[model samples]
Target chain A: MSCIPQTDLTKNRIEEISSSLAEPAWLSKERRLAWEKYIATDVPDPKADEWRTINLNSLDLSKLKTTKLNPNLGSFETALPDGGKLPKEMSAALKQYKEIAGFIWQTEKGTQHVYLDPDLQKKGVILLPLSLAVNSHAGLAEKYLTKTRKFSHDNKFSLLTEALFNSGIFVYIPKSVEIEKPFLLGFDFVGNTCEEAVFSRLLLIAERNSKANIVNVLLSSNAKNINASPSLSLVSQLNELYVEAGAKLSYAELQDFGQHVFYNSRLNNYVHKDAHVDNLSVAIGAAQSKVDVATYLQEQGANSEVLGVVFGTANECFSYNTIQEHNAPDTQSDINFRVALKDQSKSMYQGIIRVDKKAQKTEAFQSNKNLLLSNGAKADSIPKLEILADDVKCSHGATVGPVDPEQLFYLMSRGLSQKEAEEFVVLGFFNKVLAQFPVPHTLEWLQGIIGETLCTQFQSQAELKAEAAVLVK
Target chain B: MTKTILTIKDLHVSVEDKEILKGVNLTINAGEIHALMGRNGSGKSTLSYTLMGHPRYKVTKGQILFHGKDLLVMPADERARLGMYLAFQYPVAIPGVSVSNFLRAAVKAKRGQDVPIKEFRAELKDNMTKLGIANEFLSRYVNDGFSGGEKKRLEILQMALLKPEMAVLDETDSGLDIDALKTVAEGINSLASSDNAVLLITHYQRLLNYITPQFVHVMHNGEVIKSGDSKLAHELEAKGYDWITQELVAQA
Candidate 1:
């Protein structure tokens, strides 16, 4: 399958996608309605506070063409087929995980491999491609897939993903089933042409009294190997998570796309009574990326914890918006987001904790911390608290500053050089948040990436200095 | 004959352009423990900070020599590598960096090479046991959320691990209780040797009672007005600082 440019985003493109996949009539009609909504909705107003930092004007929908999906490959062996080889870097990355219950690997073309432990299958766990699940479990698919549309109506990017998503995965954990190992879902975008666009979706459901963990990894082929302009490729993704009553779920996403890709994502978590959810997002690679994550506590005794770690370098820009809404009494929520920037990179974070009038005895908190590693790096944080209940405990805190000179001095006083001192402080700054990661392997992987990035930065600076000395001589 | 370890000649230092150390002159010799006692604003801490190359303490007009090498030109890390250590009165906390990791890095930097894991662990365990610190202290972040006594003990532990030649204990006994003071004093005594020297800075004579000093100097208004034997400490404890300051004013 290849990406072919369409003159415009029209109903014909949506119909073509639906017909090519032989989608059910209800889904096809839903796609047409979503297409109309996408066309009718206006781009986010640049003058607004949330959109001011993001420049969507540079993104032209006409230039991005969607790829046609191949037929779903169900129940593949442990090894991928000859034609379904992953990129070398992705393969190397996957080798680091020694234990996982199962994994589904997909590229822009389509799902390449799907694997699950037979024991899990016997226990009534369902893991398959979204396209395949729609046919095999039509009742469950239709109910949850349509539920996401109600919350994504006002955003242009969300509407686009709803209308044109060609690849996705569906995961279901039956009632009272507890799984110790996490399921890995890998998405690799290997575009060989400019303006290629990929829209992916994820639907996860943890039934009553169930427990599960899910990890989503987003990667892209190295741009230097392709003949197309790397900066022109686009990726849009949406995730829908449902944690039913008395259930528990842990979700983590690690995004390290190609160097020059434009990426956008949104995650919506619906947590029910007596349920708990732990969500973490790590973003380290991309030219310009925007993300929105929201958690809704819809019943009493519900709890949610959200965490984010962002590291940007070079001329990359990242923007994040988060919401913690307490819709029921005795609900609890907390959000902690940390960002570190170097070179001329910039970051913007906006978070709000909203408590309804009836959410008495609620506990909500939000905090965003930014560390600038260079003089040119910039960060802006905005935290808001909207509490309508008098008995609720709510607070928000935000900080934007460079590495503390005193901390650096304290470390240096122990005999470390300036560079080594700064590195230690920066790593320590992020370790506070990383210590909370539920999975040990994920924590180790993130630490390795952060360490490598710091080394690269320091090495380049040393090289520049050496070159200057040579010129002077 | 004992060798000269440090010399401060007509030293002048400033903080934010305000002179804190004015023409303060003193000297320390190898193997000798010296006590510097003064009031709150008498510039004892300022002198300690300046010796450790704190950037905020500008040496506007001063000369500090460590074993005949100019100390003012070197940075703090270089000063540390040159066998100079300062136990701050208020140790800054570095969150998320475990004590063991920080000590390992510091030891590597000071020795200019990495020590093997087995040796480092053994050394840490030995020192912790001697100082009465639990094994859990090694895994905790460096001085983060530590009680006053714990912070002071960690400082001494670092001094024990680094093994500097010229150590400066800047008001290390300020917030410690009697039991903690004895433990820290014992640690210092065990680490001291004929090849190294210590300059103990304190406000009261309480710490001097535990770790007896060979020489005691009284600093007033940024200058060492008088120097005497260990008896001077006992005298000051009995009569207080007013007699010394009054003697100086009468002479003027």
Candidate 2:
């Protein structure tokens, strides 16, 4: 395979990366283009309020290495607590991130494979691996390949991703094809492998009047070297989930990785006239994570909603930024993020709602609330609104505090312990956001997923024993 | 007597350091209904809150015995589990939590298990209907948007489900229109049984028109200065509270 780069802008390193698997000219060129874009983007600066809390300079990219997976990988399937199925809200595995369309990618050996739904391809949907997409579907892929992930646009890691981009999926939804289930994207970082670098990209473009739910999940299927570096997973995702006139798009991004893992995500969305875009995400499993989601309302009556539920535990650090841009008349945008932080964890939420002059009668609200479980835990919230339209209604609110003790006392006075009381109150806050919209079985599943962590805090063996009895029942 | 369910002796209570119930003494056996009537600041509500073990109501001195067990020694929830319930004049509103949901948690906390969902729902429906509360009320947050009458009815509904042996209804009839007042009275009347004791605290004599009490105690200046049967409510209503003030001052 001639996939290795010819130049030294992180090029020579490409052959060793590709020659390790053998040369493929088309694959090398795709990686080369991605590297160029990554190098082109600027390093995120502290001056940018959105990236202030994010420690971009602290990343050790020299550790991100990619190698082959073990020969015999075991199944990573296990029943979720209660043996109940996961929330079935998302559309099925996406064919939109396949190798058919011009897009390049990165993946570790023996794990973290991207599976595209074959049926979607038959519907004229192009789901291609990004690297392969460059040779086969270059036109569409080139437009957004490095717009967000390239170095010139961002920094060295962004450049590093462009230079050593490995695994990803590119999806193009043809006009008017509605996918029933979410297009599911799963990245399984294999355990104890020589793989260091993880540079991945996923492009999603939906045409007018089409609809689908996309769920992107990151998981460390194996603990493979817990110390592995370039252990960095720089995922530059450009989702032009353009909900054309009357179209709809629902997306969920869930990140869960091993300790000390560095994960960064960039999500972009554009909603057209009378279209709807919903981005629901949960960030729980990383040593450090930074997520930036931006939504643009391009035409009249377009709507965008971003709902996030995050829990930061132990020494974890989470940074979340959301931008709601109202470009047209009568557009609506709302971002509600509820987060809970425990132990010494830290959380930062910065949300901006901007309404342009043409966006008269625009309605936008941005709010973030945090529940600090421990005295050492800290949360920073900065919610702002920029309005250029006099007739628009834009408001932003941010609050960071521990759960109200009075509420806890109320629940406890009803027989819950101090810990159970806090859990109830924290979950109750998120329950407000949950009740605002129609979600799948997300509440029940996430409850089971999150309850275990909270259950350990019971001071009274009585409460724990009571919970146990219920569990047994 | 039918196993004294509640016994309060020299119960001294205070709020923000101001003594409210000064050395009060009271006793309620199982299967008894007693009314504590007094003017606005006569410590009737304070007595109810103190019994419920509200943290703010400082019990400067006193021992509250319930079912022959030490009441003040236990926490509020433990005290509740021991069969004591209080229907607040102003029920707390918890936003985002449904009325039925709050009831369900209270039920589980009282029962210590997940009651079969269907049975719980059916019981809630029956109780709400019995209290004349609309079914839509169950879906709203607990007392969040409830009118005065609805909050009172919901309190009785909870009292019905919780089935506490000794209940302290603190002016349950306050702020209610006649129709809403009737709804609450009817709910309390339904809970009237030989196994439980009801302490209906009030200032007006109208609520007595609906649910007749076995006895009425006229509380004044942190102490019940006068006691009588159901007829006392009528006598006080006819002469107004000033008559009691005259009698109290004369006694002093």
Candidate 3:
């Protein structure tokens, strides 16, 4: 391994990172090209509709470090340096999910724990760290990693992630192998004296006729560390999902970072003939977050559903851009995004449903609803529809307003205090989308986060366990 | 002697600076059912809203006493806790809140404690059976996509669960079919007792036929210009409220 000076983002630093990872020739060359593209791309025009609410100037890429602190790997039975003690949030999540097919935990240092069921491994399932996958399964890695370059080119942060991703995971399910349980992936960031930057890339491929569910969680250490001056962090994540013909995949992502973390994520789903993909994203943390999610129905009979829930409190800011693209005949897609803001929080939601000319018999629907809980809170919703085929059906709706006084009055008349009434309405606002979540653990986790954000009384771990037992019964 | 449950003395209310209830005076006693008859804009609904403490309906110069305590100073929720309930004419829909969950919360607030799940479920089941509501209605969102009769039934269901001492039925009989009206009227009758009173507001006398009132007051131009036994409602229903307005004009 060659040692390079950790300085600002530059061509030399990119080459050093590529060589240090000992990546294959093709990947190294691709990273160089992506670096070129990253430099050539311009910051979003401030006057543009999508960029008006987002301020990127505060993100000083040069001041953030991209070096991995720890390079060793551990297994589920024994995670190193901490004596097998997981972070509090991750430990809670682990206890919540009693029957998971696999688990992977990655911190700023490196992969700390990994576990896969022996049965799945016997069936030719491969779940490995990205750095190891490129060498052990180089052919598969090159194929999918190259395909991810075709999306989100206009996003400079996405290109930067492509060129300098230091940590990642690779998941592959062979043909006809159905995993009944979900795989849990956790990414944690710990703050130190310097402003650290994390670029995580995930490539998941569900082969033809295979099925799987994956839950990805992004969390950070304590807020006290994050609030320390000059100790901020920037997290840039890129996820590429490929649902082969007749395959099904359910992917849920929950982001709960600290107060000083700036988060940017881009997810692209490539769905093939007769394949179905359900994607749910819940964001309740982070100082500022910008997420781009898109699904491409590339073949006939393809279906995709996208759902998002965001609860912002304090001065947290969130922006979401979603697209549902139908490129073939008889394709269907739906998008529902909801956001609730309190205190001085702000949110922006922009969605588009695009149907190609040849995509006849396509049905697409998009809706966004925002609820503001205080005078200082604000939300902006913009929904667009582009249908090139006359035979296709497409519709979109958007609403942004404070809590309905009439609804509040109705609840109050039923005997709830003002605070309790508002909390009930806010939770109810998110209920429709939460009900569509594929995993029960994810739903419960999201509920906990929302309850904490609303300052509602939190149940103890024992109480939650008892509640789960009752639910099971 | 019957104890007084609600007393309104020289009650005047305004909505958006326009007087809606001009100097209304009325009294209701325990174990008594009072029917309030008026035209659409005669401030019958305003009086109900003012009693329940709706912020939009301001009590400009009025004194409302509930069980001998000042009612105007309390908020809507406090009034609810004080055993006051209003069956709205147009109950607002709360999406994503299941009927069971909302009812549980309301019951908890009214009783100042969480009802045991088993007991809550049993009571809900019993009430649903009585109201002709399906078992599936417990999980459905509150008033969302519910039929008019269903909304009215849910209102009465709330009354049953809360068991308010002073209940105001504001046009509860307006949108119900004959069968639904009978069911709701029966629900009201079952809940009324010697410890509670009912103030039934309606535009027609059809509901009184099912649930007879001990007293009926005809409100014309925000004032109770005529009061008598239930015969007063029958007279107004037959005479079309014209005779009362003409009598008031003649008296003026």
Q: Would you list the clashing residue pairs of candidate 3?
A: none
Please, what is the TM-score per model?
A: 0.94, 0.83, 0.93
In candidate 1, what are the lDDT values of residues A1-473, reduced to their tens digit?
A: 66565653567877887777778877877777788888899888876656666656546677787777896554566643332366543443455555666788888889878888788889999998888887888889888888876765466887788888888999999999998788878888777656777888899999999999888888776666755353356788889899999999999888888655778888889999999999999888777788889999989999999999998888777889898989999999988899999889888898978899999999998889999988998898988778899998888899999888888887788899888888888788887787776765677666776777777776787688889999999
Query: What is the lDDT, from 0 to 100, of the residue A24 in candidate 1?
Result: 81
Q: How many backbone clashes does every candidate have?
A: 0, 70, 0
lDDT of 3 at A383: 83
Q: How close is candidate 2 to the true structure, as a TM-score?
A: 0.83
Query: Per-residue lDDT for A283-387 in model 2, tens only?
Result: 777777777778888899899889988887767788888889898998999898989888888888988788898889999988898888888888899887788
Q: Can you write out model 1's per-residue Cα lDDT over B8-71, one digit (the tens) per residue?
A: 9999888998888889988899999999998999999999989999889999897999998999
Ranking by lDDT: 1, 3, 2
Give lDDT: candidate 3, residue A260. Answer: 77
Candidate 2: segments with Cα more than 4 A from true spot? A1-59, A66-121, A126-139, A143-163, A193-197, A221-240, A456-473, B136-139
Error of 2 at A446 (Å): 3.3
Interface RMSD of each: 0.7, 2.2, 0.6
**If ranked by TM-score, best first, what sequence of candidates would result?**
1, 3, 2
In what order do the candidates fall by DockQ, top score first? 1, 3, 2
